[model samples]
Target: MIEDQLTEDDVLLPTYGPRPVTFTSGAGSWLTATDGGRYLDFLCGLAVTGLGHAHPVVTQAVADQAARLTHTSNLFGTRPVLELADRLRRTLGWDDGRAFFCNSGAEANEAALKLARRHGKHADPQKVHVVALDKGFHGRLMGALKLTGNPAKHAPFEPLGTWATHVPADDPDAIAAAVDDRTCAVWLEVVQGEGGVRPLSEEVLAAARAACDDHDALLVVDEVQTGVGRLGEWYGWQTTTVEPDVVCLAKGLANGLPIGAIVARGVAAKAFQLGDHATTFGGGPVVCAAANAVLDTIESDGLLAHTRAMGSRLAAGLEALAADSPLVTGQRGRGLLRAMTLSGDFAPAVADAALRHHLVVNAVAPDAVRLAPPLNVTPDEVDEALSRLRAAVADVASPTGASPTGASPTGAAPAETDGR
Candidate 1:
């Protein structure tokens, strides 16, 4: 009955534009809209559902935990919360690591921000500055938004404090120059998910590590969309040559449940003392139980290796499409997080066409259509998505087809606007 009345998004806040479809149900790699059309899900809810919709492991764990105890606050200890913290530490291979749980990626980054500030003040009161890369998406909160590299997101909410300095993501020299004795932390995402799925260079990562070490700052990796086997590794930093002192995690951590955490080791682990920071719904048993189940399923199913293998398959498919299609320029990303860069800024129109053809994806940028499928996506599902995406591309690139952004289909720039 509610599904009948849910066709429009008028009652909700105008934070998001009109949604394309109202999903009624979903399984692995597929969702059923109200119209009974089963759409192939390649976006995985912006790379959050790594295990796919309604995963058995996560579902059962949440059910079992919810049936028992749900919340007890951080004032008391809970079994699932303690267990998840230990599991996250082991997964990161940080024996002395400590974790602070929250409810979303933004909250995780916000906590890390406070931790960095506190750690810096302990050394020197003036060392409160942070360095972040241009185009990096940290979070939407005031503190995390300031640390984010995108200025457009900060324009309307301007004067968000002058504590963070932004620099070029690919230029290691800029990174080195940005971090000085006054800096307390350097924030980054292994693969810039919201920045068009761009992967950072190893040289830049190494430079961040070296600068943090030289200046007594913390290297905080935002693994919100790249952690827990999404990048073919437990963490994105592990794929690079350099290791960060701390990592902000969310998205796929609880396999769709609202959960976030920052895992820190060495000095960063000890940065937060008692009564430093906290959350009421953070680290609750139900969410932690769901997270543990996600980790357990990854290990039991050997999903890290599976993710690498499937990623290769998806990469090969996109490359093949690029070779055949005129709209594609190239493809770039690590593991399952990828983008098919367009010849012009027509990604949003392509994405809109994709939805019409029963495929779920989004334009991570004006020219980059991002594809972040489930980490446990099967070979057949990957192939199906490619086939549907191929059709979507054809629908947009047809000679007589009408372009959504009113530009010619022959590589002319469609309005320079973000699709998502």
Candidate 2:
């Protein structure tokens, strides 16, 4: 177990509240803890490791690039970056598109917001405000944080520099009412991953598109968590008929490597001039090479089709489980990105129980559990995850079970209830 007893604060910043279990290694759909126990990794690095941990092709590409060239910065061009950019254009179906690379999802969204503001300023100086959906998450950076719709996350860092407004999601009328002449862009997520895995309905998506068109405002879609086949497509926007002017992507872009990108088109593409936006380690050779390998592997191995099939199977299983258990109310989201709504705030307890059963899942909300397993997760592995989840649910729903909220299990089945 490495035998180190030092607390997190002793050596690291107090930015994250990580779990106590330390994993030593991972491969495919499983992770081995430092204590030599293996667990099914459904979290997949918070949807970054879509190809699974330590993927062979990505690992080889990283190794080769490290031996050849690691970083040349934005001062000089690199072949890997150029090739990867070209591939992204084709994959994303952007004919007249431009790409800006960064190190994280927030950076990508920040660049998009900046580009939209610049585009608006170029048209008219009064167009400075941007609109985002309620419950939408952009990033933690200043510009991105201002664009985020969550009030609690923004309350602490008051007086955000950017002039942005938040509107209710799935309501076109609300979007139309909020977006005016001063609005430069409308930020949206096809699926709200952080906000209980809510997917935008087709009518609501159409409303956002129509409103942007009517206002001459840029439609900026954030695909940070739902992009790269997580939603059974290359990009979440591709699932619907609406088109966005700016698309932000990150997370699974490089299969766990730190990479983020913004793809802009038409006026938005021309908004940024030389020195308007740049980054030091945005598209270095190593990460770009890793990203290229990810794209190639996804296409060559047909992970997209696999993701759709597996996602359907997983959703069916979840639906059946919910039908059998009163504790579970319903399910939402698309493809591999799915969530189960609990009757009470038992998500943390269920997650803890799953951990004890040697499985990894995330409590995305107080009453919601999200699942974003690897795209290549085998059917057998998914079956195993379902089994573990059932056991975890049973353990938490037992009559004598310990509840995280210190409340009795109101939805618990009778003592003789059989497994669903």
Candidate 3:
């Protein structure tokens, strides 16, 4: 579809803000716009297209499954669903655990929250309080939103029922104080993806683990953005010493296809009775088949190691950029999920300038420019992105730049720990 005929305003929900560009097609780390212009995609649809766009393996799997079977009621069992679940279990080392499938990160987290609530009542009826960290993002659904620490996103939809408490990000003392016997679960993101690529400190994660152990609360890790090989490891929790009882995953699970799941272990796995939770399209054959292809391709192509090496190259290049550019604050994040803090409110300007240079990026926060390129992105692509990023930053820092404030660029404060 052309840009004018399919503009979001032409026919769609008004919920989404204005988009800078409309894409006609995508392949690998590049996107083709309707205007016949090509742009390097560093955002990867907010890390959704991990295997890159129009991957042969994933596309073939979807086509093959669609011709055979697409959807079936949960009353029947499907091979693809069973195989995908087993693959996830083995991939994450969640031996013998159960998985609940859904359609999005929000749904996956909602299932997790419900499981935690059910498990909480097993001990104390009043243990429904969930502790989350500041800047940690869960999802848009009511239950999951309550677990998120961003009050602005949840303020408009007031009177949320869940009683969730927020603690300072990476603060051990705050986490220790908030999680206690009254708390039913501690929900956290090992690496805050939406909050601006901030990784939680090991100290705070350890404290949360200890607190959950002491209070008998379920330790839940929201790996929605950090899981499925986004963080070099299969899951971000693997990088940390803490192992969670419940793990949430969604983004990139089926490449571009929508799929979410909650992997629960031990007693937590039994929290939901047969009739308590269900989803019609959660583990549909087509999506599961596509998921299997994604996993297979990741393993066969050695994308994890590629992702690690590419991530290191990106980080080193960004650090070098920081040394030369006064507008750059510092570098933060891991693997392909990374961000650079910009001086002033110049992130949007930098993103705009990047678009002018045929590059796509995301200004997640006022000062944060996030880059979550595909896992299979090559070293050459990483270098090209960095080169474009430098030019974008330079343009934004120019005297007649695109800064909203139009003030001289002042370096961002050295507070690298600001979660998200």
Candidate 4:
């Protein structure tokens, strides 16, 4: 008799490759695999769980809200959803801001895309074109995918429409030239998460802002990966000189919960009227309550200041690693969102090595290893991650075992403390 085998390919679609490890549970900055082995979580599930896994506050909020009400659809009002919208507006510092809730970054971008088109069609109908930067990644939905600048992701699904024009990320003049009377919005990411963790030049950002002003177009910032204190700020755009009319947020808003929101101010706020767009589970009470808990924890515990301090420590550690290693070129990016730039395109191998050493990180680009730990990450945790990363580097860059390192390949015991 043949064995009854169950595999990821047997029941699930192969959108992602086969998994190597199965996690049983997680707490702040640490994950436990099925084998009872512990791993240091540096990627934070693609920078989504800024507050880390199983946060007490968020867990409690979810329990309370679920006990009271799970969902009521968008037709009815919920206190958590209403309070969440007001809280988001307060964080954005846009008193006149309006929000549309959704399920993911892609949906947030989709809603913004439709709103931009609505705003444009209201004016002349010909002003529907969008200007976006190359290497920018908004989302994977149809309209959002078109706004995304990478041609590789778009190649699989062609006929994405020619509404958007992509230009070089650092070229300010080209961005200025791309916006014309036909443009309705200029899409950009302050820090390109999937495009090699590159930060846009202030000149390019300023040019986009200026061009939008001149053409009467909306400046929509994709804050999906950079929002909710990932960059040591409320939003990445807040650290830049240019102010945007609309910003799409997701990822860290509700930690691991599926939540997305777009906050629009000024004329952009009025672009979408009642019934312009809607979602069933977007503003559900449970998720909104979870998001409120996330906000409350960040504010009450002062994660912003803690993230800044820890970011500095992490940055300094990476710099020290680069200085001592021959393979690493240096580091780029700011705050907690950082990349270890390598001299060669061996980021995948490095990431694999990191995984083998029980560290969770990923290759944001061919030559960059992205490290985005939790916002309230402790100093000891940061040091421990650096140690593991160094060991990973030693294993890859120095296969002969000549490299000097501090951490053990067998995985050292993590610090006992869990939260900030």
Best by lDDT: 1
RMSD of each: 1.7, 4.3, 3.1, 5.8
Query: RMSD of model 2, in Å?
Result: 4.3
Q: Rate the local accuracy (lDDT) of all candidates.
A: 0.89, 0.86, 0.87, 0.88
Give per-model TM-scores. Answer: 0.97, 0.95, 0.95, 0.94
The reply for model 2, stretches above 4 Å from the true place, is 1-3, 403-420
Model 1 Cα shift for residue 119 (angstroms): 0.8
Tell me which of candidates 3 and 4 scores higher on TM-score.
Answer: 3
Q: Model 2, 128-175: lDDT tens per residue?
A: 899898889888998888877888788889888658888889787888
Q: In model 1, which runs have C-alpha deviations exceeding 4 angstroms? A: 1-3, 6-9, 402-420
lDDT of 3: 0.87
Instruction: Give candidate 4 misplaced runs (Cα > 4 Å).
Output: 1-5, 400-420
Please give the lDDT score at residue 398 for candidate 1. Answer: 89
Can you write out model 3's per-residue Cα lDDT over 217-274, one digit (the tens) per residue?
9999999899988889888999789999999999889998999999999889888887
Single out the weakest 10-residue window by summed lDDT for candidate 4.
411-420
Measured by TM-score, how close is model 4 to the native structure?
Answer: 0.94
- Count of backbone collisions in candidate 3: 2
